[model samples]
Target: MPDLFHPQMMGYLESLVPQRHEVMLEMEARAREIGFPIIGIAGGQFLYQIARMMKATRIFELGSGYGYSTAWFARAVRENGGGVVHHVVWDEKLSSQAKDYLGRLGYSDIVQFHVAEAVETLKATEERFDLIFNDIDKVGYPASIPVIKERLRPGGVLLVDNMFLHGSIFDPANTSEAVQAIRTTTKLLTQDPQFISSLIPIRDGIMLSYYVP
Candidate 1:
């Protein structure tokens, strides 16, 4: 993807973030080494701040990867007087890695891991959540909205990542299914009366939607 933010600006923003735990730093290093995508410092810190600000206790993440983002939410939940964060990803190995990492981070008590299709797991889950974070494949974005709406309590928040698709969403010629799905999801969140939404251009663009129900 092209530079979403100028290199200097991105570096400046990253430099401003306070130091993180050694484990979290290790997770960042691992992502860089493998070219794996995590939310990065800015996005992870944003999630942490939002969860803390809202005093969210019950959080569900649709595409948690090795618990980098999950650790942030877990920390917030811990400071918010304790609650649960559901970490749902389809990969068993990723889930296992997350279990180990979060356990080392002392968040084993705060997070629940699931190795299943994320949207389907959310739909099957009976309990409503105070916050839901969606970072699943872009093609699944549109279909996941109704399920997210149903699972998130009224006044709860929904954070969807990759809304920019590494700048692909802005290209009219890129009518790929993933891009179109993101477009449709954007319209669903912004145009729907039930949601109050804004696209935050941090990292890859996260769609923050408040479900008014």
Candidate 2:
């Protein structure tokens, strides 16, 4: 499979995003340094836009890494008259790092940190969310769908990252567990009667699904 995005095009898209907070910039740098995969500038901006457009007050993020995407959601939640954004990741060290970064960003009140398996944590949570963002390990994507659907309120939105798997999804020969899971998850979302879905070709690909039921 070829690259889904040209280098220059991705750079242009990133450049269009307005300046982020210093903490966010630092987090981006850290991701780059550590080869950590936080959603890039364009993806983060898009997430913020979706949350703002929907006026999503309550957001739950699966696989929040050092709170980069969580910051974006927390910002929108704060602007939408203050709400909560749950940040869940299995790594305690990453969760601690996220807490420090979000605390510095002054989103400590709006963001809740959790160190546990993201899907289980979301399933255990009692409050229905207005928006749910999933960026967990691709192999887990299919299994996570049922829980995500149950957790989201009617008319809520689900934003899923890495839908393209860097264009491997288009290659018939590529049938790894992660790729297969992505395909199955895509099928589940797009073919389901309860949701209207579109795959947006952002940095990687983000599936934006609106739940109608």
What would the TM-scores of all predictions be? 0.96, 0.96
Stretches of candidate 2 exceeding 4 Å from the true structure:
1-5
Off by over 4 Å in 1: 1-5
TM-score of 1: 0.96
**Can you write out model 1's per-residue Cα lDDT over 1-213, one digit (the tens) per residue?**
996567677567778889999999999999999999999898999999999999999999999989999999999999999999999998999999999999999999999999999999999999999999999989999999999989999989999999999999989999999999999999999999999999998888999999996
| Residue 141 lDDT in candidate 1 | 94
List of clashing residue pairs for candidate 2: none
Worst 10 residues of 2 by lDDT: 2-11
Give the number of colliding residue pairs in candidate 1: 0
Write the residue-wise lDDT of candidate 2 on 123-192 in tens digits: 9988899999999999999999999988999999999999999889999999999999999999999999
